[model samples]
Target: MRLKVDFHDQTETLTPEQIVLIENLLNKAAEIEGIEEGSEVSVSFVNNDEIQEINREYRNIDKPTDVISFALNEQDEDELAVIGEGIPNLLGDIIISIPKTIEQADSYGHSFERELGFLAVHGILHLLGYDHMTEEDEKIMFSRQEEILAAYGLKR
Candidate 1:
């Protein structure tokens, strides 16, 4: 698939290798989700303060989150129509808190790369209409996340 990833590193937390790893993981995620070719996804790395502001503004949660997704296609009929017309599918934006990622990695006893990949996959799944709001949905979404991570060699 023609997956176009636009990466914005507001925080210089990722090395070149880690950046490449994230892109590869996201591409694999799109493939697994059966996303159409020529789709586009945006990934942004930000600090805790920036993410906390975004979290509060968008989700009204007054706290920093590890990741946040803004799905462009969800509930947007015009966007869906463009996607159906062979245009590049604008999947959505995935904003990640680099500091939060590091904290979670240490707390969870995993590599930063693994945690980053997990968050990226999680955000992408959300862009693809996956949610963990209910128990059954949580089971399905978490299982898929693990499977995708393992396949991409980012196992926990």
Candidate 2:
């Protein structure tokens, strides 16, 4: 249940509770997936401008996204394994766009907290290698997200 979180944006202000919420949600995901308890994960907050740059750089898309996850689990395990003493599993990174999250929350008729929870869970799933490039994939991904969010009482 050890996670290292880092924020990379200026405008995405979050309270300590919100930070802890993300950490809890990450641990919930790991627990449901039966991953190790001492897992390592990082969540980063970003503004639209910063996310736009990352989207273009990594995804070749020129638009800002609500959230994006870069997974370390899909790569070579030996290469990614930490050498430190009792180091947790390095899951990877979740980058969230602040302004975009606000707008999407408004657009989707949900509270800021609910939207935040959804995006955080979504990002974790991606880090766990879930994608929605197809219809069935979309169904499974969204269902799992809804299930987790509901369990956390974040469902609408």
Candidate 3:
């Protein structure tokens, strides 16, 4: 399935190659998850300050986070579908902190691209309804993340 990933770089620091990597990584992840073709997801890059403000406002947290995801299609199993035929599913928005990506990459002793790839996949999985509130859930979600990232050649 072809997933359309729209990116808005608030930090404007991503190289063309980084953008392409994110797009390709997300598409690969979608394909692995069996997401339908034409589904749309948006990813935005911001600085620590902006991400902190967003985290404060949305999540009641005052600190900056590495990434944040806003899922658009979250629904219960019995919820009725409102989307029409041929309409691409509006998956969600993912916001990443450029500074955080750099910091985390350095802290983890990995490449910047690897950290970015990990954040993008983590956000997309959140949009896909994967959560890590519990140990078991974290294991499930994180393993899936590792599987996708390894398949995309981003390992650490």
Candidate 4:
């Protein structure tokens, strides 16, 4: 699968190495999840204030979140249709808060890279229709996240 990840670092906080790492991890994740060729996803890095504004506007939550995902293809059965055969699948956006990631890494006692990878994978999973709204779903989603992270050698 040719997974195209468009990264927008609004905060300009990610290094080249970090960008490469995220690219590799997200590609592996797309392959494992059977995303078709030319599938596209956008990842954006923002500050706490920007993310908090997004959170409040989108989720109606006032606090800044570490990561937030907007999936484009969560369609009901009746709404599903084949746009085209050769068209790229637009997965959606993964918005990450740089400051929140740093704080979470410190709080979780893990590397910033690890936390970043986790959030990226988590966002991708959401794009693939995974949710943790229930206990069983949480188990499935969290376990998959850990497994993917471990497979990519970003183990906690």
Candidate 5:
């Protein structure tokens, strides 16, 4: 599959290698999810303050989250039936807080790369309609995340 990732770095915490790794991880995640070829995804890195503002404005949860995903192709069954095929889907955007990622990494006692990969995979799954709002959903989603991360050598 041809996955197009548009990366926007608003923070200086990510090195070039880290950025490349993230792109590769996103590509792999897309492949694992069976996303359509030529699909597009956007990733943005922001500070805690900026992410907190977004969380408050969009999610109404006034706290800084490690990552937030905005899926673009979400539609009801009726809308989906009317939608035409053969077009590349715009998956959505993922916004991550650099500081929060670092904090979580330290707290979880994992490398920065592993933590970042986990967050990115988590966000990508969200774009693919995976959620953790319930126990069963959380199990499926978290299992997929661990599978992808472990396959990528980002094991806990």
Candidate 6:
């Protein structure tokens, strides 16, 4: 899949190769999910301050999150039909807090690549209507995220 990826980082902590790795992860996910080859999605890497602002505005939360997904087809009843046909679904926009990602990665004792790949997959899963509001929901959501990451060779 073709992703119009835009990663804006104020700290410049991630290198060019890291961006390439992220791009690869996104493409692998799109392919696995059967999204169209030319489907477009945007990825934004930002500091905690920006993400906190977004969280406040969107979710009425004043805290910064690791990732947030804004999907255009959220309320579309035809989502299943659209995806089943393997059409160019405008998946959505994903915003990730870089500082949060690093913190989580360090806290989990995992490499930055693994953390980023996990977060990217998680955010896209949200765009695809996956959520963890309950124990069963968490299992399904997290399992799918891990499956996508492992499929792309991103293991923790």
**Residue 129 in model 1: lDDT:** 86
lDDT of 2 by residue, 1-156 (tens): 544555454664987788778777766777777777677777888888888999999999998989989997676756654467776668888988878878988999988888888999999899888899999999999999998887777776
Off by over 4 Å in 2: 2-9, 76-87
Candidate 1 C-alpha lDDT tens digits along 91-139:
9999999999999999999998989999999999999989999999999
> Model 5: per-residue lDDT, tens digit, 108-151?
99888999999999999999989999999999999999988877
Better of 2 and 3 by lDDT: 3
Which 10-residue span in candidate 4 carries the lowest summed lDDT?
Answer: 73-82
Residue-level lDDT of model 3, residues 5-59, one tens digit each, is: 8999988899999999999999999999999999999999999999999999999
Clashing pairs in 6: none
lDDT of 6 at 70: 98
Sorting all predicted structures by TM-score, with the top scorer first, yields: 3, 4, 1, 5, 2, 6
Model 3, backbone clash pairs (residues 3+ apart or across chains), number: 0
Error of 4 at 143 (Å): 0.2
Report the candidate with higher lDDT, 1 versus 2.
1
Give the alpha-carbon lDDT of every model.
Answer: 0.91, 0.81, 0.95, 0.92, 0.90, 0.85
Reference-based lDDT, residue 150, model 6 = 85
Runs in model 3 lying further than 4 Å from the true structure = 76-80
Instruction: Rank candidates, lDDT, best first.
Output: 3, 4, 1, 5, 6, 2
RMSD of each: 1.8, 2.5, 1.6, 1.3, 1.9, 3.4
Please give the TM-score that candidate 4 achieves against the real structure: 0.95
Q: State the TM-score for model 6.
A: 0.86
Residue 148's lDDT in candidate 4: 86
- Model 5 / residue 69 / CA error / Å: 0.3
